[model samples]
Target: MSISFRVSNSSKFQVSEFILMGFPGIHRWQHWLSLPFALLYLLAIGANILILITICQDSTLQKPMYHFLGILSVVDMGLATTIMPRILAIFWFDAKVITLPECFAQIYAIHCFLGMESGIFLCMAFDRYVAICHPLRYPSVVTSALILKAILLMVLRNGLFVIPVPVLAAQRNYCSKNEIEHCLCSNLGVTSLACDDRRPNSICQLVLAWLGMGSDLSLIILSYTLILCSVFRLNSAEAATKALSTCSSHLILILFFYTVVVVVSVTHLAETQTTLIPVLLNVLHNIIPPALNPMVYALRTKELRAGFRKVLRLGLKNK
Candidate 1:
């Protein structure tokens, strides 16, 4: 893919496509690895779809929280779909060639969805904070308009900031290697192959990551802290328990998602380019949360489970 940009006009070398090595050290085990990953991808897609359908069908769930949950399902599906198919192709069929444009698109979608997921988490945190802290004002404060605006902001924040990551990478002079050792088109992995200095790409990615996901996580922590304070001050033990229970699923999702994110971030920062640990962590980060999120919500939230059951019953009756 020859990008005829002003800066790279004099560059003699250009890579048309990239060869993904797909776990360089584990070539023998890739077939076995594909089985579990494929299963996880299917579960992620299926569960999120089921959640979306239930939320849309159940009138009682037409509240602000459920609306956010529905948006989350869509994001989860996008997140999983962004990289899993290519990964499966690499593992199953040894189909690892990705054109430059396709790789750039994958990079953009992955980071955008990740940033949006962070935003959704923050929005869900705010929802819980208001519901628990100001029950009286919840109806007024967390309105449909508010949800729409939050989603719009979420999309813009990630969509715009993430563009630079892929753009910076794509603008680089790939005069050397055109092979990536990772399963997906990770920014760092792709940029490392460029003949030019990757400092700009690195700096851009680091700054945007902290500015987007870092801020969202910090605010989520603040919201939860305030919610905890309010819960403890409650007069009745049962009420406190109920408030905590309501946040249990969201908390679990937060814990798992951020934990993997932190590990991956640390590995990237440590510049552990020689090991497969970071690659594996990135795969887990992309796959596990989407698969687990809906299950957590369905099992923890009585309303969602009931909604699912009702949807199932209605479907059966119609048959």
Candidate 2:
């Protein structure tokens, strides 16, 4: 994939690379915004790595919840790394040009990781549901083997479903403008620049979002609904409080994830009025959750905090 400003052929139909306009109407000095974004990326990567190391070294956290949390940390790292570095380059160095192949790869990574994260959240909700609703069967039902199988399924399901998005997108003939209005190579952003019929790409992306994220969210809501029912049935307030407390962190993360997604989707319809809003939210959707997920878990979940302390103590003793 070569980055060339010149047309490859006499035909204007032949395009080589795309120019990413980091923020459409933002001022030049606003490039300083990269500082905070860089900090978020660093914190996200560092926290996720620490979470994974703590989970691996501590046998006490070898349960379904922590196993899923470990997978989430990995997904968070992938999600953040996929867009942050390139975006920072665009912001800091004005390196906005991306070859076609690289753009398509970013599109694929973003969709795949987003789908995987949604599936993981669903799995985590089921874990909470079982532990709260079916305490007697929780140990038997949510086994290590079962968590492994669920992880494999989440990976396979999301991977397979998201392949068509980038595949269909890449096949399209981008004959006209090659400048994308957003930082990352999003499906809609890239497809909008195509000179050919982008209906197929749009339809496929919409279908995948509904089938993958929509279904996962539905199941999550159902699981939490049942969990709420179970919690309310307990006779004592302390029991109810404990049960709800276990789920609060997960719920907060879920709210953060889907709220941005929904706002971005909704803003697209009215994009003409507020062009920068959707772009800003899309970038935030990728960075904010990853930066916050581990912190939320460590602060709210008792087991995770204990594991974090154990890892910190081990490090101190080693020194």
Off by over 4 Å in 2: 1-12
Q: Evaluate residue 194 in candidate 1 and report its C-alpha lDDT on the 0 to 100 scale.
A: 87
Model 2 lDDT per residue over 194-237, tens place? 77898999889888899999999999999999999989999999
Cα lDDT tens digits for candidate 1, 106-175? 9999999999999999999999999999999999999999999999999988889899999999888887
Models 1 onward score TM values of: 0.96, 0.95
lDDT of 2 at 62: 86
Worst 10 residues of 2 by lDDT: 1-10
Clashes of 2: 0
Instruction: Please name the candidate that would achieve the greatest lDDT relative to the true structure.
Output: 1
Candidate 2: residue 84 lDDT (0-100): 98
Q: Model 1 off-target regions past 4 Å?
A: 1-8
**What would the C-alpha RMSD of candidate 1 be, to one decimal place?**
2.7
